[model samples]
Target: MTQENHQKKIITNEDLFDHISGFKLEVKKTVDDFKSEMKESTNDLSNSILRLESSVEDLRKSTLEGFDMVFKTIDDTNSELREELKNDNIILRKEMNQRFSVVDKRFTIIDDRLTVVDDRLSSIEDNMTYKHQLSPKFA
Candidate 1:
C-alpha cells in the first residue's frame, strides 16, 4: 500500500507539472500572436504613411508645374500685348504727324494771303494821300 501511494503521489506531481507547462505554452502563444498583430499593424501604418507622402509629393510637383504654366502663359500674353501697344503707338505717331503737316500747310497759305492784302491796302493809302494834296493845290 505504501508503494502504491508513492506511485500515486509521483503521478500527481507529473500531472501538475504538465498542467503548468500547458498554461505556460498557452501564455507564450498568446503573447506571440499579440506581437505578430502589432507588427502587422505597424507595417500597415508605415505603408500608409509612405503612400501619403508620395501622394503629397506628387501634388506638390503638379501644383508647381501648373503655376509654371500659368506664369509662362501670363508672360507670353504680356509680351504680345506690349508688342501690340508698341505698334499702335507707332501708328498713332504717324497719324498725328500727318495731321500736323496738313495744319502747317494751311497756316502757311493763310499767312501768304494776309500779306498780299496788307500790301494792296498800303498802296491805296499812298495814292489817296497824293490825290488829296493835289486837289487842295488846284482849288
Candidate 2:
C-alpha cells in the first residue's frame, strides 16, 4: 500500500508540470505574434508617410513651374506692347513732318509770284512817263 501511494503521487506531479510548461509556451507565442503585428503596422505607417511627402514635393514643384510660366508670359506681352507703341509714335511723327513740308513749299511759291507782278507794273509806268515828255517838246 505505501509503494502504490508513492507511485500515484509521482504521476500527479509529472502531469501538473507538463500542463504548466505548455501554458507558458502558449503565452510566449502569443506575445511574439503581437510584436510581429505591431512591427508590420509601424512599417505600413512609415511607407504611407513617405509617399505623402513625395506627393507634396511634386505639388510644390508644379506650382512653382506654373508661376514661372505666368511671369514669363506677362513679360513677353509687355515687351511686345512697348514695341508696338514705339512704332506707332515713329509713324505719327513722320506723317506730321510730311504735312509741314508741303505747307512750307506752297507758301514759298505764292511769295515768288507776287514779287514778279510788282516788278512788271513798275517797268510799264516808267516807259509811259518818258514818252509823254518827248511828245510835248516836239510840238
Candidate 3:
C-alpha cells in the first residue's frame, strides 16, 4: 500500500506541472492580444491627428481667400464712385458756364437801351431853349 500511494503522488505532481504550463500559454496569448489592441489604437490616434491638421489648413486657406475677395470688391467700388463723381463735376461746370453767358447777353441789351434814352433827353432840352428865345423877342 505504501508503494501504491507513492505512485499516485507522482502522477498528481505531473498533472500539476501540465496545468501550470497551460496557464502560462494562456497568459502569453492574452498579453500578445493586448499589445495588438494598443498598436491599433495608436494608429487610429495618429490618423485622427493628421486629419485635424488637414482641416485646419483648409480653413486657413478659405479665410484668406474670402478676405481677398472682400478687399477686391471694395477697391472696385471705390474706383467706380470716383469716376462717377468726376463726371458729375464736369457736367455741373458746363451748365454754370452756359448760365453766365446768358447773363452777359442780357446786360448788353440793357446798356443799348440806356444809351438811346440819354440821346432823346438831350434833344428835348435843345428844343426848349429855342422856344424860350422866341418868346423873349415879344416882350
Order the candidates by TM-score, highest first — what do you get? 1, 3, 2
Q: What is the lDDT of candidate 3?
A: 0.88
Q: Where in model 1 is the C-alpha error above 4 Å?
A: 1-15, 137-139
What are the models' TM-scores? 0.77, 0.56, 0.63
Clash count for each candidate, listed in order shown:
0, 0, 0
Deviation from native of the Cα of residue 102 in model 3, angstroms: 2.4
Per-residue lDDT of candidate 1, residues 1-139 (tens digit): 9998887777576798999999999999999999999999999999999999999999999999999999999999999999999999999999999999999999999999889889889889888888888899734
Clashes of 3: 0
Q: What is the lDDT of residue 106 in candidate 3?
A: 86
The TM-score of candidate 1 is 0.77
**TM-score for candidate 2:** 0.56
The digit string of per-residue lDDT tens for model 2 on 32-128 reads 9999999999999999999999999999999999999999999999999999999999998999889888888887887888778777777777767
**Candidate 3, residue 14: lDDT:** 68
Specify the poorest-scoring 10-residue window by lDDT in model 3.
130-139
Stretch of 10 with least lDDT, candidate 1: 5-14
Give the CA lDDT, 0 to 100, for residue 84 in model 2.
Answer: 97
Give one digit per residue, the lDDT tens place, for model 3 in 49-121: 9999999999999999999999999999999999999999999899889888888888888888887887778
**Most TM-score-accurate candidate:** 1
Off by over 4 Å in 3: 1-24, 111-139
